[model samples]
Target: MTASSLTRPSSKASACGCGMKRRAFLRTTFAALCLPSLARGNGPSPLPSFDRCLEHFMAARNIPGGALAILRHGRLVYARGYGWAQREQQIPVQPTTLFRLASLSKPITALAILRLAQARRLSLDEPAFDRLGLAPLPGKTRDPRLEHITIRHLLQHTGGWDRAVSGDPMFMSHPIARACGVPSPPGPRDIIRYMMGRPLDFDPGTRHAYSNFGYCVLGRIIEAVTGHPYETWVRRDLLTPLGIRSMRLGRSQLRNAHPGEAHYYMADNRTAPSVFEEVPSVVPAPYGSFCLEAMDAHGGWLASVVDLMRLSAALPGHGGSLLTAEMWQELVRPPAPPVARDAHGRLNDMYYGCGWLVRPIQTPPGHNIWHSGSLPGTFTFWVILSNGMAWAVLFNQRREANGLPDTEIDGLLHLAAAHVQEWPESDEFPRYYRPSS
Candidate 1:
C-alpha cells in the first residue's frame, strides 16, 4: 500500500459523520462500498464517518469489503461494514458477522489462563511441567531452561524458546511432540508431553520474545487443572460472564454459525494457488493450532468487531465481570524493568505482560499497554487506556503489495490510528463500557 493510499481526504463532507459535505460524503461512501466483481457482496451498515476511511482503503487495494467497530470510553459507539460477507453469493456483513480473529484470539485465551490464576487453581510462577503432569519423563531431554519456564514466562514470552528453525510450522505441523520429546500430537496432553521433552532454547526469564509454544503449553495446563476442555472452560468462565455470544472455537463453530462468512483474501500475486485455494468444508489439521484453536487457550477463535470492542472496554479485572481493577492495572503496567520502551511507543526492548503487548502508548504524555495481531488475510489492532478509554480496528484484506514490500494491514492500522481521536462525550455517541457486574 502506498502513502497516498493511506492518506485520508482532508476535506469534510456534511453527510459524513466526520462532518464532511453532502456530495463529498456520498462519493466517499460510494467508494467505500464499491468492490470488484470478485469482491462484491452485501455488507452490514456503514460506520458513522468511516465512509472516507473504508473508501480510501478498498479503492487502493481492490479489497472486497470489511467491518469496522469503534468504541468510545467503554461503549460501542459505531459499527459498520464496507463490503460483502460472502462475495460469491453477495451476502452483506452485518453487526453480528463473524471473522476469523487469527492471533487476536490470544488475549481471549490468555484471559482464561488469568482467570485460573485469579482462582488460585494455578500459580504463574510455579513450574508447569509437574503441575500439568509432564514431569518425570524417560530421558528428560527437555531444555534445562525448560525447568525454569513458568506459566508467567509463557504468558509474557520470557520462556527462552525460539520460533521454529525453518518453516515455523508450529501450528500446521505436529513436531512439537518430537521437539519436546513427547509421543504423538493432537491429544489432550500433547503440549505438556512435548514441553517436558524438548531442549531449552535459553535460560528462563533471561530474555523476551514471542512464543506461541508458551501459550500452547499453558493451554494444556488450563485443561489439566480445570478438568474441562480449554474451550469449555473459557466459555463458561469468561465468555458467559461478559455477554460475548458471538465468539466460538475453531473453524467448525464458524462454519456452523456463519455459513455466510466473509471471504478472506491475500494479495493476488503473493499467494500461491495452494494457499489461496479454497479451504474445504471439512475441518483441517492440528486441532488446537493457532489458526484452528483460536477458541482454545492459545489463539484460533472467531468473533465480531462488536464483541471485540466489548471485551476491550470491560478489561475484566479481579472477581468482577470483565477483569478486576487490579488485573487491569497489572495488565497495563510496565514489565519487569529492562525498561523496553521509554515514554513514546518506540521499543528499545519490549516484552509481553500477561496477554497484552507491553509498550509505551506514545501519545503526548506517554502511557503503556497495547496489543496488535496479524495473520494470512486479517489484521487487528487495539489500545487500552488507563483512564478508561480504549480503541480497536479490525480489517480483513491481506496485502503484500508493490514497493512498500510488507503487510498492507499495518498501513491500514497506521491510517486508522492517525485519524482516531479520543471519544468525546456528546448525546450523539453512546457509552458502551459499563462496569463489569
Candidate 2:
C-alpha cells in the first residue's frame, strides 16, 4: 500500500452495530475493562516531576508540546502533557490531551485481528483471498505463493507486498482511483487485489521488511469477517473491551472530535513550532502520509497517553480482556528465527510479532520488547519489559525533516530511560548546570 492507502475514513460512518443494544453492549464492556486507577488516586501526582522534564526537554528542543505515559505492572502510574497543543491559538496542552497515533495505531488494529483469531473467527493459516473472498487484480502477478499469505503474514510485515513510499498522490486533488493505478482503489476488498498485481519481494517466510500494504489487507480482512467497517469493529470489539474510551479509529471522527484532542503538526525543522493542520476529518490510508482519515485499516487511530497505556498494558498476556492468553503469547513471542536482527551487534535478536515490532532490549535484568512510532510531526515509543516495567514517550514535533537530527528526540528518550524510576522524586531531575558545591 502507498502512504495514502493507510488513511482511515473519517469517523462519520456509523460502525456496523445493530442499535441501542450494541451501544449498551459496548458501554458495559467498556465499564468492565476500566483500569484500576483511572478514577481515584491519592498517590503523588505524576505532573510535578514530569513537568520539569517536559519543560526542559521542550525548551531544549524548541518543541511546543508533548505527552508521555508510563504503566507499571498494568497500572497507569503516570500521564503527563506539556506545551502548546494549539500554538497558533495559544492553547496549552494538558494531561488529558489526545493526538493522532499515526502508525502507532497499527498495534491496536493488530489486536483487533488477534481478538478475532482467538475467537476462531479466522485462523492464521486462512488464505487472504478465501478469508475475505477478495478477487485477484487484473494483470497482477500470478504467484501461487500468495495463496499461502495468512493473517499472520499481514501482522508480521512479511506479506511480500510492495509499498509505494514518499508521496501523497492519494491526498492530492485527484480522484483516488486514478491516483492509484488500480481500476478503482478497492475499498477493504481491493487491498489483496492490489497486492496480487505485484510480485513478492521475497518468499513470505524468508526474511522481513516493513510493508503497510500487508497491514491494509489485514484491516480489510477484519472488516470482512466481522461484517462491520474496520474502525467500528475495532472500536466496539477491541478498544471498548480494553476500556479505552477516548481513542477513535477514523479521520472524520477525529475532525469532529471534542476540544481536548491535540492537533497535528508538520515540522520544517527540529527547533521551531510545527505548522498545524486542523482539517475537520482525516483521509486514512498509507498511515504516515497526508493528514488523518478513516480510509486505511492498517493505521489511523487517534489516542491519548492513557489510551496508549490501555493498549500497552493489555497485551502482556491478555489478563482477561479482548484477546485470550494464548493469542497474546503468540503476539509477544519471538518471530521466526530467520527474521531476527542483530544489526547493532546487540546479543539478543529482535523480530516482528503480530502487529508489533518486537525488539529484545539488553538491559541489566535481561531483555524487553519495544516498538516506536514516527509520523509527520510526532514520534512515540513504548517498551514493556517482561519483568514488569513499561515506559512510553510521545512527542508533538517532527524534527528530522526540518534539518534537525532525530538524535534530539532520541536523546530525550535515552535520558528518560536512564533516569526514569518507579518512585517520583524531585532529585530525579538532572541539573542542566550545577553550581560548584
For model 1, the stretches where C-alpha displacement exceeds 4 angstroms are 1-49, 135-140, 164-169, 172-188, 252-257, 269-291, 316-321, 337-350, 360-368, 401-437
In model 1, what lDDT does residue 327 have? 60
| CA deviation > 4 Å runs, candidate 2 | 1-52, 138-141, 162-176, 179-192, 252-258, 269-291, 317-322, 341-348, 360-367, 402-414, 417-437
Q: What TM-scores do the predictions have?
A: 0.72, 0.71
User: What is each predicted model's overall lDDT from 0 to 1?
Assistant: 0.55, 0.55
lDDT of 1 by residue, 254-314 (tens): 3444553555655552322111113432332121113343225555667777777777665
Superposition error at 80 for model 2 (Å): 1.4
* Whole-structure CA lDDT of model 2: 0.55
lDDT at 119 for candidate 1? 78
lDDT of 2 by residue, 1-437 (tens): 21111111111111212122444534432333232222222564444434444555455457767777666666666666667787889777655677766566677778888888888889886777566665556655577778877777777876665434422222332233442453332244444454465567677866666776577677778878989988788878877765666677544322465567665565543222211233322332222234244235554666777677666666643243556768867786655545554665433344678876554434432334555565656666555555554655666664544443332332333334333455443321112112222
